[model samples]
Target chain A: MKRSLPLAIVFIGGVVFFISYFVPHYISEEILQRQIMVEWIKVISLFAFVIGLYSLIHLHVNKIKRKVDNWQYSILTLSGIGVMFIVGILLPEKFNGGIQQGSIYDWIFMNLQVPLQATMFSLLAFYITSAAFRAFKARSVEATCLLLAAVVVMLGRVPLGETIRSITQGFLDFPKWTQWILDVPNTATKRAIMLGVALGMMATSLKIILGIERSWLGGSE
Target chain B: MKKFFLNIVNLDRRWIFLMVAIVVSVPLFIPSNPPIVPARPVQELYDFIDALPEGSTIMVCFDYSPDSLAELNPMGRAICRHAFSKDINVIGMAFAWPSGSGLGQEVVSSAAKEYDKVQGKDWVYFGYKVGFAQMIIGMGKDIVKTVQADYRGESLKNMELFQEVKNYDDVSIVIVLAAGGTVQTYIYFVNTMYNRPVSAGVTAVMAADYYPYLQTGQLIGLLNGMKGAADYEKLINIKGLGTRGIPSQNWAHIMIIILIVVGNIAYLLEKKQTK
Candidate 1:
């Protein structure tokens, strides 16, 4: 009954969802159905966050009780969370919700979180540069072509290429080169990703429709 | 001697981090002149606004936080400035973080004051809601149902600007300014589902992924990164933060390229010696 019930639910939902796309008449009905789904999603997601916070709170509470090393971090986290919640709830709407929470969220967001996130992401710049340098080492014919392509793209995207081509006034436009890279090669790569993404989405949708995959229910048997 | 020499090649990541930090920061102080970028995307976006008829409705969902202020906020300013200048009926709202409600209102209020636009008549900001995907869906069904009040908890139903904007059906165009998944979510929730036209301004890294949607005509316009913001400002002849940001970004990229070239030359030289 457990499996059959889920399978039946899937069968009805899958067919309707699929049919809703092809038939415009059912689009409104489909949209309305999706609205309910979104509400449920928000509710469930908030619950999951609470579940996660339970662990966080438990860890800190236990640490404080046990006098674990560096237990002060827990106090800081809990207190911050408490204050944030209070301020968020206390803030009047005229000030735009959390602005009443004021600079605490702003300061934490700008000075701490923003820089930290940017720092983490800036790691990508270094990593990508390293990867490009290493991978474009080009010890072979194909690799050499790749290296040349990378070089062209790198130069093409900047004004230096234009400076080199200043006499011709044709081959050097960085915008033109950037456009070519983006329009031609980038589109090709993107198309490949798109095709793969589309196929995967369709396959997953089919699985849901046919009752073959039910992972959304968290290890549903 | 080999161990000592090779140690430089196999340097700790902290060393590279320090170098990158200095490289990126150095450019901010002594900006290398990057020729202005007047890209087509920004032109198309400007043209889109320019072409809109008088009193045309422009619905903007501010879906970013202050974290992306450096990248997306400048473009937001340009959008507000341009829209207000053209006498477009601007409807501003937020759906990302709760913090963004203030940011969204700041755009409209500042623009209104600058252009002498009457609030609740020329533009109405529908506040920030935590609904994310749900808000998009709700707005699609009934704009008022999802957004019954302004950023100040005032009723939007009674507002003249919102009087005609009942649902996705009424709004002429949807503009989403986002940092994360909000752009795609908006396209999915509003544009794709309802046949409503949409465009967005997004962070540089996240910008590349939306090309397919652009191709499909699901997204009519895009402003990506600080570069795009600069382009928009250039188009409008404002020349603000976006313009100032470019030289630093360009120089940072140049430094990384120089590093790449050095590393390659070193590797090639080492390979030859070994041979």
Candidate 2:
């Protein structure tokens, strides 16, 4: 009964949402979309966030209690969350109805969070160079072709790519060549992949709706 | 010679890192604006905005975070500048991520300030909304009803900018500057469902994947990464960070190319020696 009940709920909810898409009636269009679907989803999303917060705090608290390795990091995480929450609540709404501009919260987000994230992202350049140097060996015919394509595309996409074109008097234009590669071959491959993904998504949706995929309901009976 | 190649084959990566650092940093001191030839997609994007009738309202959705600020920010700023330069009204919103609301505000405010455009009549930021697809669909039906207030807690009902914009029908085009799947969401819900024209500005990595959409007319134009941003700045004839960063990018790309060539040569030499 425990398993069957949730599955039935899922089936009913899925079917209703699916039907609501096609039906143009006011009840289906307005009531279902605005009140039931959007409002409920928003409320559920908020609750889910709360649940996530609780889960995170609980995990960390347990880790600390058990004195796990790197338990000190948990303290840092909890402290960060606590401080941010306090600041957000205390700060006056300055800009739009959100956090106050130049408040401690905003300052932390802009100065600390922004730079940290950007710094992390910037590391990709170094890693890409290292990985390319290590793995991109022109050992075989296929590898050589790939290496050539990579060089051309890389040259074509940047300002230096255009410099080459100007220098060569249009006899060689990396930008034009890059555009051709991206437009034709790249687009073809991407479209095929997207088609496969779309079909897979549709099939998965159907499976969930028909209760064929109950793994979401948790462990097997 | 064989020993030299062997040493190079196992060369430490720190040297490559140092070269990249020097290549990227040297351009900042040397001001070189390499002539920008706008890619077809970027040119199309520029042309589309340039061709918009004066006083046309374009919906600019900020769907990216700071991680993508380096790329999307300049594109967003350039589009806003273009819109303001042409006297096109803007209705800004963020439904992708919460952080987008703040980023959107910064872009709009800075552009509007430069153009001496007022907030209510010239542009309005609708701020972040919770539900992604539902919020979009609702905006399609009734934007005022969906988004009750602007980012500043002001009621959007009284805002002059939104008076003409009832929904997607009233807007000229919807341009989404995104680092995530929000572009696809906008394409599906806004463009496909409401039949509204859509365009996108995405990070370089995600640019190649969206070409099919551009080809299929689902996307009117696309701007990919910092290079794309540089192209837009050139078209507008206003040099920004995008322009400044291009030299660095050019130098970095050249460095990578040199590294790859050198690495491959070393590999081939090693292989030949073994044979």
Candidate 3:
């Protein structure tokens, strides 16, 4: 009964949405998909967020209890979440509370969170440089092409790339070449991949709708 | 000379890290004006916003986290400044991440303040919502019903900006500044479904992925990483972070190229000697 009920719901919802694209009637497209389904989604998404938050806290708590390697960081994570929640939501409006600008929530977010996240992302520069120096070798024909492309692209996207035009008295334009590579080969490859992905997604969605892909429902049943 | 090349090949990675750090940092202090010839994609975005009539509206979706603020914030700020300077209504939103809402508020409001643009009237931020695709699809049908309220819990119905602007039809363009796949989501749902013109300011890593969409005319324009931000800043004639940060980017790129070339040379030398 549990499996059948959920399957029935999925089939009805999926088929209606699938057919709505073709129908385009005001009631189906506007009222059903846009308004009605959208509200349901918003509500379901909120619930999903709550579940996600609970799952996060639960996982971290379990890690702490287990004394796992690097588990101390979980405490920091939980503390951050707790502090942000209290300052962002639980506090009263009289105290300049809430996630609005000028609030404590905004202050922490801008000062602490922003810099921390930026620093983590910035480390990519150091890591990529080290990795490239160690591993970016042209051992084969394909590797050489990739290496050459990478060098051209790296030079082309920066100010140094544009300066090539001035240096060669307008004879050499690395940026222009880079743009061609991106526009032609890059676009063609990306389009092919995207089309494949879209088709795969449609096939997967249809399978799930038709009850052939029941993994989302969980369990073997 | 062979030993020297071999030593370079075997040098500790810490040396590379130090070299990168030095190159990236040194350029910040010794500033030079690197001429920014605005790329075609960037110029298209600038021209599109420039062509909008006064009182027209555009939706700026801050679909990135603070991790991307360095590359994306400038684009957002530049777009807002452009829109506000021309008396265009700005409807900002961050449906991708909760953290993005803070960025959206900061970007739009900071620019709005410069032009003395009133909030709820001249500009309104819908803030973060949980449902990304559904929220976008809903907004296409009716924005007020989809968003319900602004970031501060103020009803969208009360906002003067909402008076004439109701849905995707009212929005002049949707510019998404994102670091992730949210831009693709906007492309699939908003552009493909509703036929609303979409553009993006994405991280350089993800920029190449969207070129196909640009060719298909799905995206009106694109901003690729910090360079794109710098290009937009040049067009807007503002020496913002994008401009300030470009010199460092230049040096870093030069350093990476030098490293790659040197590494390859060392590898080839080693190969010759072994043979």
Every candidate's DockQ is 0.31, 0.68, 0.83
Model 3: CAPRI class: high
Return the TM-score for candidate 3, rounded to 2 decimals: 0.97
Task: Give lDDT tens digits, candidate 2, residues A1-221.
Answer: 98999889889989998998888889987898877776667667767767889999999999999999999999999998887887777544653223645567767878887788778888888989888877898888988888888899999988777777888999898888899989998899999999999999999999998999888887777
Q: If both were scored by DockQ, which would come out higher, candidate 2 or candidate 3?
A: 3
Tens digits of per-residue lDDT for model 2 on B1-275? Answer: 66776687587889878878899999899967577888889999899989989989999999987788899899999999999999999888888787777778888988999999999899988778777777887888888877788877788888887778888999989999999978888898889878999999999888889999999999998999998999999999988889989888888988888878778778888788779
**Candidate 3, residue B63: CA error in Å?**
0.4
Real contacts recovered, all predictions: 0.19, 0.62, 0.88
Identify the runs in model 3 with alpha carbons over 4 angstroms from their true place.
Answer: none
Query: Against the true structure, what is every candidate's RMSD?
Result: 4.1, 2.0, 1.4
Model 2 native-contact share: 0.62
> Order of candidates by lDDT, top first?
3, 2, 1
Clashing residue pairs in candidate 3 are none
Q: Which of the two candidates, 1 or 2, achieves a greater DockQ against the reference?
A: 2
> Which residue pairs show backbone clashes in model 1?
none
Which TM-score value belongs to model 1? 0.83
Q: Cα deviation in Å at residue A133, candidate 1?
A: 5.4
Of 1 and 2, the candidate ahead on TM-score is 2
What tens digits encode model 3's per-residue C-alpha lDDT throughout A121-219? 988888999888878999999999898888888888887887888899768788998899999998998999999999999999999999999989888
